[model samples]
Target chain A: MKGQIKNTLKGLMVDFLFWLYLFGCLYYLLHNNWGWTVRNKFILITAMFFTGLFFLIGDSLGRKSFLPTASTNRKWSHSVWGWLLVIVLIVTFLVGWNIVEVNPYKFFTKFRNAGGITSGIFDPSIVGYQLSNQSLEELKLDGVDQEILEKLSGIIGKRYNTRKVCRDDLKRILDEEEFRIYGEILLSKTEKNMTMLNQALTALAETIFLALLATIFAIPFAFILSFFAARNLMPHTFLGNSVYIIIRTIATIFRSIEAIVWAIIFSVWVGIGPFAGMLALMIHSIAALTKLYSEQIENIDHGPVEAIKATGASTIQTWIFAVIPQIISPYLAFTIYRWDINVRMATIVGFVGGGGIGLLLMQQQQLLRWHNVGLIIWLIAAVVWTMDMISAKVRTKLTSM
Target chain B: MSYLLEIRELHKIYEGGTHALKGIDLNVRKGEFLILLGLSGSGKSTLLRCINRLIETSSGEIIFDGKNVLQMKGRNLRYIRRQIGMIFQQFNLIKNLSTLTNVLTGKLGYVNTIHSLGFRRCRSDVAAAEKNLERVGLLEFRMKKTRNLSGGQQQRVAIARALMQNPRLILADEPVASLDPATADSVMRYLGELNKKDNITVVCSLHFLSLARKYGSRVVALKDGEIVFDGLPSEINEQKFKDIYGEEAEEVEIR
Candidate 1:
């Protein structure tokens, strides 16, 4: 009789708290962001009714054994606290939906426009890939006026008529001849894939060189810094400890920043080109590779180190005889892997004016030339695929050795 | 003046306050095979390591060849290490390295390391490494990696590497502990041969009394970091063995 009376008091307190929680959620959601409207008020009331029903089931049937094999004293989902949590989650989702201002109507409108723009870019870019005029002839448009072509050609002038036209000249030429080629593209016909191929090859070679040079430049510095960062190699003195800590902190800070940010910093420092991109890639690789190399150094068999030291070898000689032999293979493998990573990063860094095929990609993006963007993307994908194959082969061979 | 190596009250207290060795005093003459017998944690390893400065003594003095070993620094310390060879229970061979390279490492202490970095080591060093390999009867296995060698073979390779140091004193810390009885006998045979034929003073730790009596010219027994007996191996009867090793120890033979 006394336990029954206590249970009734607990039920009354739970009922009061549930309503208080609902009221608080509704007040927070409405007062801050969403306005106090009848629709929202009705939704909150319905949620509260369900929450209360869930708790009633928990109190009335939680202790009853439903299965002969199973013995459970309580149901977590049917409990008052669980029901309250479910209602809170639902309320949070609704509030977040309102905060994001998600409007399906605007998305549909832009979604339609996206189709039209994509189709337009696709048509021109695919046509640009065609080397022969056979496709253009099938368009059946009349030939462009020679007089108008002369006027546009004269604007480009003889001096600017080189195999690799300067950027400013190309822009001027494109502006003048864009309308001319709009029709001439339909009328003209011939094999001139060389120009486009040359441009692509140049940018791709530059990207590979950028990654290669950066990794090469970073190797020696990273190798030297790794010894300083290795805990066991560093002396136990205060000065030695400080040097280790400083190098570790600096490498971590450099590693934490993205390669693109480093590219931007270097681009400003060295003027927008591949040199800046190389510097950016090199700095980040140094920090990253040093950490890897140092860890490898730290984990090697100390038995060999002790053996070497016992031979009366100096510190440097000990490192040469014991440490270098153990780490050389791993260091080389890491370097090859880093080059693969740098190759991918080079393209992204170029978007920030670091120089590579990414520069062309950015240019095409800004000009709304999505077809050209697709072509550049394909170029980067090809490089990545080849690098994957090469790095894998090299690592396998190194491991076998 | 008769002593080649002298220890005057060497005390070693580890960082966690474990007194590993308590005021050990001993003297070793030139061209002697002295065996240190002790149970586990009896300071045999600590005493050997302290002699080489592998582990620092908390407070003590060690004099080697009329020079204060505790006060030696930099080049002086390395000079002493060059003369004192060490072998571990595990053999401590760089397992992945070729047996030849492992032997060559012993010469690293004597040579200028800068010139040895590339594939071309000093030509004479190569010849000397080959000579040491031949001395151990492992010249045919010189190109093979040490990991492929057997336990006794690996210990022999370790001996060969030590021979390259031209050490006046060799410290063997339970060198046969990891090997089987037959293999242990062979490794011990090699150490004994070096002690007898080369006239190298050896300070070695051992567990079995049979090997100690056979090879050791003198025996020193330690119990709880204190010297319990320091005399000829023949003098240690069953009573002295019971006192040094606790009364509970069962007498076990190694062969």
Candidate 2:
């Protein structure tokens, strides 16, 4: 009889909480979207009246056994609560539509704003002007003026040079100086393309290595932290439980923030470059891999642990022999998966001055050099594809073995 | 008779309020193959684990080899545990590791932390592991992963692992409960041999009466956390079996 009363009280508390939450959401929606303020006493009173009436009706029906019994094969859609659910869903969708200000016509209307970039991408500037290897002294003797010589000095010779000739200078150098163009333009375009390709390849290599270093750096930290975070491995004592919670909470917080956000903060701290990018990725990967590795630890077979402990193995020995053996395959699989994600994240980190092909791509994009942007994009896609294939193959092999 | 193990007023109450062991007292003599027979959840496993301090008893006195194991902590407890090896029904060998590594893990109690960290077993330890494996008839399969071995083979590997401890007492917790009838007999034969040859005090739990009678020197039957019968294996008649197992229980033949 005491248990019955306690159960009834618990059910009443749950019902009250359910009604409070439902009304709370309704009030938020009505006040924000329909201008129904708290001062609107009449509407508020009517809502309260309906809520009370509904509960009273339900209570009375339940007491009198008027509601459909569990044995009855009632169709859920035909129920009153079902209709209310459908109404709530439709109202939420309508509010979402208004909030986002959905307008499909603007897509077609505003598309031409992207016309210049689209055309530039369509005619990718693959060909570049190959600068002559003729010495500055030779150019001066060839009757080239000192000003033109200085301008040409910035664009030529250094295969890894970042500077490119401006439009006006390029036209002047190519058109007005008939002597230079007739001798240079035909053969130099391929050489110029080669230089661009070479730059792309170098940036690609930097991006991959940056990702590799970040994954490698994160592994040891994550591996050690995972033992603390794993619920099964941790003791049920107060200190152990607290440590588990602290590690889990920290990991969750780190993982919640995107790698791009970390990159932005790190780029500021470390003053930009692949190092900052690697640092950002490493932090994110440590948190992500900790969560993965700990979960694998939790799912390990308890029997081996029990057996090991029974053999009078010390904590460290038990971990090495029993726990580590079971987790190695899954840990390797998670590490490879994290490395794959880090590679993709490395390219994006560059957008925030974290440094890689993304930095080069961002610069080209801002300068309206869409063709160079297109080239960087192509290289990124190819590398990502190859990485995807390799990770997939390795993961399958690890799991199968 | 020298008592190898002594249990007095051992009571275990789980967090879920399960009165699994309710005030038990028993004494085990040296060189005795004591077979524990009981229904599932009758505290057979609870008693075995308590001997090695595997499961912390709520309130009890467990004296193993003249030392009060309940009061022992850290190194002392490990020392006591190493002298008492345990086997399980599931044959809990590390499946991903080779049979040799699994056997070597049994010697973890004696190994220093540095050697364990590097997973470097001494040459003598490796030789002992091989000898133990050969004793279990698994020396040829030492390089194979335990997962690739058959169920019976896996249990033999578990035995080899236990041998690495050089235990004076072997606790078999329903070791052959998962094996076939023939395999179960073969596994018990190995334990019987060890009991006879090495004079190891074994406290094994089992559901099968046939295996118990054949291998056990004495049979101890428990009913609802209290011993109902303690005598020679030949003394467990039909009436005694019913008293321990309850009215509706019928003895099922393994063969």
Candidate 3:
């Protein structure tokens, strides 16, 4: 009698939870996505009541119905349900379109406005002026000869023969040693230099290292947590089950928050720099890698574990000898893959004051220096491509080994 | 009688209440080679695992080496396991590890937790691992990973691994079932040698009657979770075989 009552209570709880979940989903869809204002109590209640009534009618009709032949009734009802489903799908799609506010005509009208920025982006400003120690204005104020000044202007203007013309002009005007110094100064000042290129390259290197550090920092933490999270390894005892639940819950929560959000949070805590970005990536990587590594652990061969246990080995010993061997290759593969993802994510994290080339890119973009932004974008693409290739090759080798 | 192991009134019911072993009473003398013959899922593996307390028995008393195995826990259970080695159909060697490392794992029971964590093997243990590999004729392949070895060679490495424990008994659950006939016979020959020369009591499960007849001094047949036949290998007549294996069953020779 007690058991029966207990089962009835359990069933009631499950039903209550199910209904709660259904209503929660309905409320979310209506309030967030339906476009109709559901803030008024009367409209909300009326809508919910109609939806519940329709659901009940559908559910009842889906089972037995009033008809002479049950088979024919089922077939007929199936068609009605199918048509209703199609209509519902069409309504949902239309509603989704309205909610997203997609405007195709705006693209054609706005295309002209974006032409300047697009052109600047396409024509990357890869080179910049090689500034000398002294500015041109300083030399002008120093009251140098008018011919020398004209010659300097000529050297700066003409791109093709600037170096040769300046050398010949200055050599004819000045003595040999003074001509050499002037030539050096002129060439240094007017040469097409790599200021933008160097900045982009440096930022890219910082981003790569930030990603590498994040992956490396996350490894041991993920490796240790994975054992607790794995269903097959943990959850045998009450304490183990609690540990499993806690670790799994924490990992899921961490993984759900993207690295960029974490970077923003860390930037507040640590002050904006690569350290914040690296910390954010490290936290996300730990969670993601814990999930992957635990799954790998869960899928490992039970045979070796059993064999090891039969050898009179302790639980820890079995893990070391049997479980560790099976998971090492896959773990290495996953770590390398995580590093690859971190490299891509680091660039994004930098947009939010978390340091890397992305910070430079964002600054240049806001200043409307599209050419500098383009150089940084190209550098990021190249570095990301190279890292992807290297990581893929390494992962293949690890897995094969 | 001075028996190496004793099992009384053993009953095993799985999680979903499948009765795998029902009221099994058995004893093993020292230095005996016993073969268990039965169809798949006839409780052979369960019985073997229960001997070492790998699978907890539903209700039974298992006494191994004069100690109550079922009553043992933690350190006691692990200590008991060290004396009883087990082999599986898949060989169950750590595939990514070298043959020497797989063999060295057998001595993990004797090592402390700290030592095991560091994977520190004693000189004696290393020497014994090499000796065991030599005994299995796998000394040359000790440095090779177990996955690269053939099925027979892998099984031999598993045997060498078991020998590292210096076990008094070995429980083999379909050890040669996946190997070819020639490899099966060769593997069986090694087990036979261990039984005779090392005086290690062995309880092995087999699918083939011919291999049982050759290596097993005594054969026990289970049908529907109950022992249907238990006698000398020669005592299994066609009628008895039919009774144990069902009327539709026909013996298929391995060779």
Candidate 4:
């Protein structure tokens, strides 16, 4: 009992230290700039809202089995339904706090005027000059006082007429100013929003497509490569050794670089956007897949391969019948796993302008609009988490079946 | 009748510098049930593998059906393999696939790459697999995953798969090693029947002397990678086995 307690304490200490070190490193990376911003606060609120929503749905649906359970039977926490209720309560509290305190609406309407018109000199001056010139021409045609018409024309030239003027002309100038300012703001917002959305979808599509293509292309190639890699398959030592070393080196080099760094490098060469992201993902995927597929090939039962070869089955035929079948499950599982990782990484690649949710995230941060940033982050997190769960479920089903 | 396989001065050195088969010579006649007997590390498995070119010989020539199997390449190698079948100790069936799919792998050489990768097989190939599974008395379990079957049942599925190849030669490398004694007996009986009924040449390696005596028409004994005795099974007496096996044979109780 004493020894067990000591061992447990040691393990706990190690775990604590590891987490502490991790958090410390993270703190260093983010530094003192961890103060709340409008965008981050908005994101926090949104995350809390969705988390609460899921929690409530989970509680109402009685889906406690999905969560990890505690060993001890503490009535409320022990049962799945009880756990769901607790989670729902916690999420609700957090969300309520965020909504009340963070106030996402403040960020949106901060620059907006009370009348929904943007108060700015440039737009009004342009509109006023145009309107006053037209009014002067009308007055001249009507043969009004020469001094008044002259004053209006001179004021329009200076573009600083701020008098009450007639209600019709004033209304027209106000409408024109509002339309110009709102149009510019709306266009900018829409362009940024659309680019961000398009980048994310394109990156996701390309990553998945390329991952599938790489899986197909790499499987047979890796099988053949494994033949050379496994000492048992080759006849000569020199050839097999050389081939193994070459493949090993290539795989190592490709896998060594982080996907984000790869995206940055490719972005420079390809000139930014989703194309760069796709190429980066493809390169990393090939390396990762080749290693996984080759290992699967190496570990297969030699008896069948030998049997096929003994029958005078060609190398290709032996691999097809004997080796390929044995490794199919792991190969597929790995491919799916890599694809999930690629999708998640593709989002981050956008930070380097390779296009995705990360690009939107950067823009929101730059603009100091925490609410939009929060929205994008929550969306990405939810997508990644859901995909992870789905992939895991699929892998389990495939392997089990 | 002309011999189906001839090995002259066969040698194999493993990567670990172990001399597995040292200056070995053997011949296998067509339609013969040959058993190779030896203790662990005696090179019986190596000799069996060398015949199929599964384990390439360090220095030797293996002539099969009058062609040098060592020098054969590409299409020729595949053509030769199509005529040979193999069974393993672990059954080596694809665990995720159904028994029928595992059996269908035997006909992979005949299918095109596109169809094979696409999971499409010729109708006749599927029919043949079904028939082979029926012959092995596992047709009822055809759609079941191989991993779900008992060890003996899995081995039967493997045999059915081998049979689907329509092989002329079958090399079993410790096919019964992982099985219970009863299952091993049944598997051996199946092999014996296959040899007699199909006129297929069979070379099997066995650890048990009784099994070898019961099934083998000819028994070849190896000691330290060298062929110590090669004769009719009846000629392998206690004294003769002792002489070939040294002091180790004394501990072996032949049932």
Candidate 5:
């Protein structure tokens, strides 16, 4: 009789907690203005009712008892351990979604806006704007309207300056699709676009060079630090082990901070340009390469190390003859791979005044110059693709050697 | 009464509590080729390693050339290591290095490590490396990497490397364990020749009783980390063999 009473009280406690938690969550959602309104109250209650039923059924399944007595298929309730966890996840997901107030309509709008912007960026306007009077005569021969041709010549005579024509004047002249001939004429009248394109190309060169310089500069420091950081080399003695831990900890802390954050600090240090970008990349690569190279050291065959030591070689002698030969090939391979990674990151580092194609891209994007942005994007893609191919080939060659 | 190496009550309890060597006490004469006979885990490897201080002993006294090897640190330890050469079952030559370079590395104890890194060994160093390689009959293959050599040839290259040390003592830890019958004999022959020709003290461990009988000037048998028999190869009678091997073992397998 006592055991039966205790069982009843335990079941009652579990059921009470489950129901209370369910109701409390619903009340909190309503109180927080998520669904307490008259129109959404019905939807909210319906959702709550379904969830409540799911948990109630799961709880009954957990206890192996039901309102009417579940039948032959009730064997599933024997494994009630997994049910509570599933219900908890479902409840948390629903409550969290409600808390965040995710709207499908708003998500769809964002998707649509992103699609429109992507389309605009891909549609590069390559029409030249600097047409001579002789080109206007040629336009006339192509059956362009006489008045539009005259307006076109006026644009060319002004050396394609937007300042020469009012905003409304230029827009009106190029407004109609039929007068796209004149639009082409206006396109042929802009010299400024060509200069912007030239600048983007030059900035792109700087970005590539910056990444190269960073990786190159990082190699010497990273190479030296790797030997100290290697657990096998340094952890043999207490002092060496402490040095290993210290170097490893510092490298990890630096690795956690992204290259851009480093770039920001370096831009302040060296004054914004490719040099600052190179410096930031170099520092980040040092931390990254130290970790990678030391792991390489740890994985090398210890047989040669022992063999060298048995020859009665000194500490540095063991490293020079045994350790150095094993690592040189892998070191070259990793450096090439790092150089490839740096090139891709170099573009973004430019946004913080670290001077690269990315800086011009930031400006062009903000100014809504989709044509210039398109040009920069294509150029960067080309450079990165080339680098990827070259680095892969070089890495294979180096490692294989 | 005279000995080149003296070991007293050596104990090696590994970190995880494996008593690999339990109070080993032995002595090695200056020019004797001593064979250590034991089953697997009989502390041959541990005892050999402790002499070189490759694995630190738990407690012991290992006196080599009147200097206590157990108490050595830094340069003193290295100096002693230079006098005693060691070869493993794996041959342990840097695989990517040429046969000559592998042999040249044996002289690393004498040259500055930084200076050695330049790949430009002095004329005498080169001549010595060549001489050692020739001694092992691998002079023709000096330019080839050790990885390209056969198991027997690689072992010989390793022997040549040990010779570069002009080692006063050579510790061979199951050097022929990995080789087939004929190849094992050839490798053992090189060690035997080195022992007789140079009068270098040799402490070798071997699993096969036949190799022990053929090569050992004196044999020390270990059973469960303690010396069971210290005598000549001819003295190991059938009953004695049973005590050393711990079972009724056939002479056929002993080969």
Candidate 6:
């Protein structure tokens, strides 16, 4: 009886930890000022609801009953169907949240009216002038003195005169008008910045293209190097050991230096452009992926190799039949994982003049346009999250087969 | 009858300065069921594996089918290995693969690397694998992963895989050490039947003396890497085995 109580307490502790982790992640998401979209609210509520439902079921079923108290049911817990259900639930929740939160409509609409007229029927500059003039009249009616209003009207009139105004005089009049309509003018500038949304989209597209190009060049090189890096495949000799050590050391050195640093170095060599970014990402990816692929190769079972060898199969044939099949799943998984990482790194590498979304983000930061910076951050997050979900699905489908 | 395998002055020295096999000489007649009996580290397994060149002998001339296999290399070595089938104590089937695939891998020597990588085995190879599995009474379990089967079933699959090789010689290194007495007897019966029916040569290393006597036509005893006794199973009386293995032989439960 005492033993049963101990087991029950242990179960409760584990449950508490799981709930704590879930809530902790949610807390961080909210604290990061990640915005209060409908998706976020749904995730928060769903997580809470599940936590409650799981505990209720556990209590009704008798904690030990839900867990595998006997060995026979342990097999059931480890079954493919059980794992599939859990994976499906998690993926459905994640993808659903991502789709709703990253609704492209909101992103595109935010910048819809920035620099261009939405309908093309009227110019924004002409509209801005009319709106400013109307706002001035409204201020006058709200008990503003006529002297101040007349001064504001004169300043605006001087700035927009058709005759060429002296540059110094125009600058002085613009400054006075800005001071008079401080809050209103600031809001109008923000709205105008939104119209230049195409710049952000172009930056995102360029970064994605660079990432894909780097991955294409890196995967093959990494695959070749992994053959020498695997310990089981290499001979038990000084030459083999030295070759493995050298390749491993070189890969480690490349991977250890951040991609951003690589980009800065490449930018100096090739001058500024996406070419420098691609080279940087390629070097880092080759290093990282070689290590990953080599580990996969080493962990493959030696049984098939022995079987092949006993059948008089050549060394190359043995590798083809025995080694390749075992490692294919891991290779696909690692490649997709690398691509996801490369996309994120490509943006960072752009900060060094390697041309991507990071370039626009830096510009916005320099301009102190926090609202525009917020929009860019959201767009980047959305793209990365979408890619992550797609890759996860692909990985699941491949490995199951 | 002409000798199918001959080993002369076989000696193996480890890098750590331990002698695994002292000077040893033996000859196996064609189509004979020979059993090497010894306790752990008595060099029975080493002697069996040495025939296929799985482990290199330090100083020896191993002549298999009139060819000095010790001096063979590249294509020649693989050609010899293909004719000599080997089974392990662990059964050593690839756990993740189905029984049919594991059996089919025996024909890897005949298939090209490209076909193997593409998983494109010839139709005949597939049929042969199925036939071998049926012989082992595991045709219905061919699609199941090897790990899902019991120990006896796995050992049967291993034997089926070996048969797929159509080998001239089958080497079993402690094939029944991991099984229960009943399973061991059944496995030995199958191996004995194969030898009698197909006239194929077999060299099995065994720890159980009674089992060796029950199935083996000839017993080769090794003590400390030296061949202490070699004769018909009936000639290997308890007194003779005692002389070779010393007082420790009494502790061995032959039953």
Best by DockQ: 3
Please state the CAPRI-style docking class of candidate 3.
Answer: high
**Interface RMSD to the true structure, each candidate:** 1.4, 0.8, 0.8, 3.0, 1.3, 2.2
Kindly list the per-residue Cα lDDT of model 6 for residues A147-192, writing each as its tens digit.
Answer: 6566556644322211222233434544665445543442242211
**The best candidate in terms of TM-score:** 3
Candidate order, lDDT descending? 3, 2, 5, 1, 6, 4
> Model 2 misses residue A45 by how many Å?
8.4
Q: Residues B1-255, candidate 4: write the lDDT tens digits.
A: 989988899999998999999998999999999888878889987887777666678999888899898897777766666677888878877776788888888876555555666677788888989999888899999999888999999888888878888988888888898988888888888899899999999989887777888999998888899988899888988887786667665634433
Candidate 6 residue pairs that clash: A111-A194, A114-A195, A115-A195
Give the native contact fraction of candidate 5.
Answer: 0.71
TM-score of chain B of each: 0.97, 0.99, 0.99, 0.95, 0.97, 0.96
Docking class of 2: medium
Model 1 chain A poorest ten-residue lDDT run: A60-69
After superposing candidate 5 on the true structure, give the runs of residues whose Cα lies further than 4 Å from its correct spot: A1-28, A31-81, A95-112, A115-117, A120-129, A132-197, B117-119, B248-255
lDDT of 3: 0.83
Candidate 5 residue pairs in backbone clash: A128-A187, A128-A188, A129-A187, A129-A188, A129-A189, A129-A190, A130-A188, A130-A189
Worst lDDT 10-window in candidate 3 chain A? A60-69
**Model 3 chain B: which ten-residue window has the lowest total lDDT?**
B113-122
lDDT of 3 by residue, B107-160 (tens): 887888787887677898999999999999999998999999999999999999
The CA lDDT of each predicted structure is: 0.80, 0.83, 0.83, 0.68, 0.81, 0.77
Ranking the candidates on DockQ from highest down gives: 3, 2, 5, 1, 6, 4
Clashes of 1: 2
Question: Which pairs clash in the backbone of model 1?
Answer: A133-A189, A133-A190
Worst 10 residues of 6 chain A by lDDT: A121-130
Q: Is candidate 2 or candidate 3 better by DockQ?
A: 3
- Model 4, residue B10: displacement in angstroms? 2.3
Q: Candidate 1's residue-wise lDDT over A1-401, tens digit each?
A: 88756655566455545565666677667777756655656656665675467445554222221211122244547454555557767987877777788888998777866763465444333223221335333433456555545444443222211223323443454465554455344223323333434566688899999999999999999999999999989988999999999999999999999999999999999999999999999999999999999998998888788888999988998888889888888888889999999999999999998898878778767886555566567777889999989998998887555
Instruction: Give every candidate's TM-score on chain A.
Output: 0.66, 0.74, 0.73, 0.49, 0.70, 0.54
